[model samples]
Target: MKTIAVLGLGKIGSLAAVLLRQAGLQVTGFDQAAKALHDIPVLSDDISSPEVLKCLCADHDAVLSCLPYHLNAMVAAAAHQAGIHYFDLTEDVSTTGFIRELSARGNSLMAPQCGLAPGFVGIVGASLVAGFDECRSLRMRVGALPQNPTGLMGYAFNWSPEGVVNEYLNDCEVIEDGERKLVSAMEWLETLYIDGVKLEAFTTSGGLGTMCETYHGRIANLDYKSMRYPGHVQLMNFFFHELLMRERRDIAGEILTNAKPPVDQDVVYVHVAAEGLVSGALRRSEFVRTYRPIEIGGKPRTAIAWTTSASVVAVIEMVRNGSLPQNGFLKQEDIPLDRFLETDTGRLFN
Candidate 1:
């Protein structure tokens, strides 16, 4: 897996290629047009064709897709047929399900949901209770927001607006009171504090990945949510419900992104907690951090960009070095947090 090809040279994709190259791997980028991003060699080609994608993927040992979720099934299918390992940052549950099915028949690894909320957060949640006797609950919350806000929404489209919308509208999976079930998104609301800053969290889809299935019998309660500034969720509920924007997610996403475009000065907050019995005593473990835009390749990148990109890059690094399984459907909960932090790119999270 020394030679890697990154598809979709957008914000996260371009930065991921730079990080992979920085990790000492041979990196190439692909997109609709050939354009230089940082120091990586980018090639322009249409990946919509299965034949073209399979041919392109065969040339590399692995393929990392940073494309939108709607196009990932095709990419994974191509990778499967090419007998090359595949990775993606998709948070779409259906897309992950399709990839999981594809992985069953393929010899190479198919890893998806390798981004921040579903990726690193899942890894952290499992690590928090690794030594517990009886895991009680695991709660995870993540947010990427404008550092300085001046709007009713108090957000910026630093991440994929489509992804944000999907998380809001889609039903969330959870394990409540030892029973696994589906719950309406945005129904469970809670207030949390980090460094004395108040914020709100609500249920969101796909953030839990496959954790419900993995922790069904082991954990009593488990859930994931998205954090936002105070009053942010209220406005969203009103906008989607009262204004009837839920019927048209595409248009809603477009309108939201245009109103609050991405900002250079942004922050990403991650807070995770797990409670269980340690030594016959109730104990709680927490992993909390606030990430801001940092310098990469002598230029600053947004917090959302670096966190999301570095996450998958580190997982790929581990895969290349044999720290992770080489084939089959890789679960984020199965990745050891210690080994993940030992990787070159994963160290950035520290």
Candidate 2:
């Protein structure tokens, strides 16, 4: 069996290691915190140290990074130098660009943005676009929210606070009128209804992954948004824009993280829509799903943790079985949605 090393034994990483081990692969974990991985054999190594990071990744066939977005570059470089494949769940565009550059010079695969929005949502969006003869417009939306919200924002810290703040503050990339453009986050707000629950969506960064470049001139309009409960965007806009929190994202992240506690009972929502001409008539296709917390390895995991971790693990399985290209930068859209859901790990979304 192939051996894999999972870095960052935090919320998503711990579950990812569990899934990898349950798949019968030899799995080793590493974390900066000593107590992050108590149930499994792990090394409490400092990821900031180049020599130590390289040594930890050198023996593995592939390394999955669940560390914070800012730390991905160091880990990715180490994995590349160690001649091992690298995968990460980062939604940071700048980090992904760096990994893409590393992949150009490395012998092993380097895949970033392997989590929910840029990951499975991109796969679903691409599939919907493929159904059209002439694609006109496409929109992808995803959200991880508390099932029973108690806060003023009606949200919780389901994932990394740094990631959340970064996406909200960064400029978003989209395709408009057959040309790629950069738009402000939290703009273009719209209301959406899912399963009779009212929610809102707005432009978000990095969720589109490489889709804009892939479908730039081919489609007239394309965008990705983050969905949230009603009134969430207004409060966020007031805090980030009116209060100038956008300029101080680090402080903003701290305030939000401290205010909104992470919840165990969370849900993940995904929706994708494509409109274009099929044959001679205009047609629209959509994919939608709501994911709840589920039991994995005899333990109940939050929906966000399971969905995010499952996506990266499924992609790793695909790489191991030679289904995906193994020697270059990999995009979420490269994996077909049907094929992804068929995998043991991807089934968690079903």
Which candidate should be chosen as best, given TM-score against the real structure? 1
Clashes of 1: 0
Expressed as tens digits, the lDDT of each residue in 90-174 for candidate 1 is 9999999999999999789999999997999999999997978998999999988888987888888888889989999999999
Q: How displaced is residue 49 in candidate 2, in Å?
A: 0.7
lDDT of 2 by residue, 32-125 (tens): 6756453568888777898888787878889999998999999999999988999999989999999999999978999998989889899888
Worst 10 residues of 2 by lDDT: 31-40
Candidate 2 ranges beyond 4 A from true positions: 36-39
Highest lDDT: give the candidate number. 1
The CA root-mean-square deviation of candidate 2, after full C-alpha superposition on the true structure, stands at 1.3
The global C-alpha lDDT for each of the candidates, from Candidate 1 onward, is 0.93, 0.89
